[model samples]
Target: MPILKDFRYHAPVGVDEALALLHKSKKPLLLGGGTFVLNTLKKTAAYPTDVIGLRKIASLHGIRDAAKEVTIGSMTTLAEVASSPVVGEHFASLAGAAACVATTPLRHMATIGGNVASRFFWVDLPSVLMALGAKVAWAGDKAKKTLSVEDFLSLTGPEARGIVTEVLLPKSGLTGVYFRHTQTMEVDLPLVAMAFAARRQAGGVKDVRCIVNTTLSRPVRLTGVASYFETKKVTEWKADEAADVLRRDLEQGKLDDYRLHCLCADLESLIDKFKKA
Candidate 1:
């Protein structure tokens, strides 16, 4: 492992101060829980000259539960998110994702900001958040902005420089399930992951959002499958039909036969579980 080079650390007390530091530094990296940042620095030759820690910022710490929405501070630890009653009650899929991340010690140190910002396909939170229709709030040197999770994941270059302040999730009538499949019992990284969210209507499913990750470069919604489900009765959902829709929608060249099999099985299992609920 490469040793992290000497770097100046700045623990800013406010968002403005943090942005100022980030803009002024030759190579500045925002520090969330330091789980991803520190680990990356130790493994790669690329290292930032300055680290702007967000720990001192008071606004980026707790969860806010409103009548129609829930806002999670970017600096909030995964462990806190997993254990929060508000999150468990409103977004159980998110809670389950948080609880299954790495292990207990890493969860205590990993923040949602870093996890989403890292944009690693294997990371659990991004898929669940995207499926839940979450939005990201960012703070930068010039101004603050809010973007949907899908848009945020596509950012690059200057567009990705801002510091994430919070994650906003609208409270909805939809129910969701998040499933993670690892290669083995000891492996933390998932081989395949799926998130399913939908509102059970009188005659069928509504507002269906089915996301698949780990087997792709980024999480992608199975729009074809979702549309198929939206038109069919919940009791009539079939595993083979769901599998055929997804196979037709996705690029077969990107996934081999085994992965395709796993994806189909997981999606079928998720749909069965969702219907039973």
Candidate 2:
């Protein structure tokens, strides 16, 4: 049985209060939906002295749709993101990733903010968010920063620690699609995944973004694959040809044969979907 050690728990109703509590504690852990943090606490040997619960903060809740963009609060759960009409309409890939996270009860308790902040490479949303060109609105003791999701994901060590206040996704009119391959249907966690987004022009596409989550490293941008597909008419896309480009894009990556095969299969599916679109 896992045992939680004695710790101070602080539920702050405001961001300012939460920050104060965070900076004051000797070892502080931020609690969002409590899906990740609570579970980590049960097994972590390096226990935090204080757990700052952000659930009560009024500012960190809800999904808001505006003329220019959609804002999802940090505390918003995966279940909420998956079910949101605005998210479903504007960012289908994000909604799909959220829906694919875990079992029903886990989705209800796991948050988008926690998922992103956890920085676990196997987690579903980051690659999709990267493909959608989302920005993370973050607050820390030093500054309030809004970083591109790609930039945020590249942060390492202490640079990654902060309060993710919200995710800002612009209404770019880009269609996004996500494909994740799990080791088994029983496990919702992704073993490898791909997120593709592009703006469909009259006969071609523009601003194409292809991001792949190897679950072995940071989500890799398939630049060659994106470049190959860019400005080409949908009719010109050949799955086999695109697979060759994908192979070149991942040549530098240390992927095993099975995962590589899976990515190639995903590429074919993506091309076929777009061709039929």
| Tens-digit lDDT track of model 2 for 1-277 | 9777899999999887888888889999999988878777888977999999998998899999999999999999999999999999999999999998988999998899999998888888989999999999988667889999878888776676678999999999999999889998887679999999999988788899999999988899999999888857889988888889988999999788889888889888888888887
**In model 1, which runs have C-alpha deviations exceeding 4 angstroms?**
none
Candidate 1 local accuracy as lDDT?
0.87
The lDDT values for all models are 0.87, 0.90
> What are the models' TM-scores?
0.95, 0.97
Per-residue lDDT tens digits for candidate 1, residues 48-160, read 88999999999999999999999999999999999999999999999999999899999999999988988887788888898899999987556799989888889888778
Q: Pick the candidate with the highest lDDT.
A: 2
Candidate 2 positional error at 195, Å: 0.4
In candidate 1, how many clashes are counted? 0
Candidate 2 has a TM-score of 0.97
Model 2 ranges off by over 4 Å: none
